[model samples]
Target: MSKTVTVEVGLGDRAYDILIGSGLIARAGETISARLPGTRVAIVTDENVAASHLEALKSGLESGGVAVAATIALPAGEKTKGFAFLQEVVDAVLGARLERRDAVVALGGGVIGDLAGFAAGIVRRGMDFVQIPTSLLAQVDSSVGGKTGINSARGKNLIGVFHQPKLVLADSGVLDTLPIREFRAGYAELAKYGLIDRPDFFAWLEKNWREVFEGGDARIEAIAEACRAKADVVARDEFETGDRALLNLGHTFGHALEAATAYDGARLVHGEGVAIGMVLAHRFSARLNLASPDDAVRVEAHLKAVGLPTRIADIPGEMPGADKLLDYITQDKKVSRGALTFILTRGIGQSFIAKDVPSSEVLAFLRDSLG
Candidate 1:
């Protein structure tokens, strides 16, 4: 019975609502049924999520008289977002005999959302999909944006499409089941919004992050704010042709690290990589005199205080050398016409896209970081 906060992603006819609150999953069937009457749905989730909350979701759907045409549960983790599983999900949806008007429900974290969304986008020339993001990362970021795809052998998210969801249900209550580490990793992305262009929000988070972690009004407010920030950006640049690229703030270096680790969760997760990459982006900006070194230090301090990895050395196990890491960066999707593009900063809340960055400069920075 908690209050629901709704944020709209304005895309003309394609617009949708992101409903944020507690107990949303239990109400998902009713909400979705009202939006697309008589349409059946296929629930695509990961094994971990299926074991935890699938029953509750199913019961909710059944209560609303929504039929689950099929259910496909893949293995959980970053590795699941690849060609093999993508094929598996596509086939499951196809095998279910779901018509074009049917829906695909992504019921887990970013991996499930991305993979299921990609399947929904391509199957039968695209089917309607609803995103019930169970994780903090999915709720605040991936679930809202239309970006969907699997990992490429070359890089993370290199093979995706912009497939916006029909609706997004973010149940803050679900996050209570998240492990502390996973929750903290998600906090990194939440903090990214502040660093991207909301210095005041960043300061607010600095003061109220503890309550956000504890959950309740603070947690819902924080997630809603992050979603609002992203919704505005996505509405302005849905295709990521211009200003939307700013959202890639920490992704360049972060993707490189994820690639180097071979998508090994034990080594690093996406948000952890992003946390470290944001720090690197700031430090590199300082090295180029684009921002003050104090800014980099402050960024690192906040991330670390929240238990996110903020440095190369923070990663567990032996990491690849600078040259190897650089090789991965070259394969990143941000590379344009063989040149590097990065979201660098001039100061807190002052990020801009830097294009055609010299490879030599990046190499030197990587060497220093690796050392």
Candidate 2:
């Protein structure tokens, strides 16, 4: 039997539990039914995940005596988080006659979690939802936060809401089915926690990452640690009014890179983009004399060793110039009153929000980075 780790996100009445283990998906229905008895559920998933784990989820729900009101499987990929599919999910849930008290089950990775959570938030003015996040990325990062939304042509996650889930089941067993690239991508988010504040955790990962990949107690520990770190931050700042923003250590530049690639999974996945972005953030900080250049080199080396892209040139195909990339950065949600707010680091585990960053300085950095 695999070990089960539960991390709680404390938001008083809005609090929920994240269950991380090997077989949680097979047990998801019991967990949900216990917390939300007699509620019908609508399972929202992407085609890729549906092909692999949807039946297990349905069987689990049935075994737990929970009625599944509907199952909607949309096309998979980052592009799925958009206005069009958001409406499709909302329409599917409402069309199935799921009430406000019934639940929407997000049964995939970060994209499904965000899209379905958004649907649950809006359908009939808010319905309860459960996140059965199948991917390591969703299991560790996106599943814990209440933030949900789709991307826009302007920027990523520009249109979203704060909608917490009732419970999250992160099944490590499902990761066995993930492609190597996808799993590596998710590892970037897991490593980000260590970069943000837990230097010890980062060092631990550097030593035990192979064990983490091999799957065992180490993987569970890494996921639980990441979830615990995020849960603590979410408990303190649910709305990202302050400390929660630190969770987005690599996201600012990462999102811009996603936009530059038009969110193409072939060119760059979210985690890969984040890996590059994190290296950029550290390098940029060093350029500002806020951190040692060695810190940037160390960060880059770690991510590259993990097989993540750590530089702008690592992206495939032709990309727009630094100016065009900066245009997308201007549209990032982190912009506050026309000034950029970035999570800059003084060292490997010393990140802080740098507010009102000069656009001219950012432009110069981009130019240098692109060269």
Best candidate (score: lDDT)? 1
lDDT of 1: 0.92
Off by over 4 Å in 1: none
Tens digits of lDDT, candidate 1, 1-371: 67899999999888999999999989888999998899899999988999999999999998988999999999988789899999989999999999988999999999999999999999998999999999999999999879999988766788978889999999999999999989998999999999999999899999999999999989999999999999999999999889999998898999899888877888899899999999999999999999999999999999999989999998988899888898889878777788789999998999999998888899999999988
**Candidate 1 TM-score to native:** 0.97
Question: Every model's Cα RMSD, please?
Answer: 1.3, 1.3
Query: Model 1 misses residue 328 by how many Å?
Result: 1.6
Clashes of 2: 0
**All candidates' lDDT scores?**
0.92, 0.92
Q: What's the distance in Å from true for residue 175, model 2?
A: 0.5
lDDT of 2 by residue, 302-336 (tens): 88888889999999999999899899898887888
Collision count for each candidate, in order: 0, 0
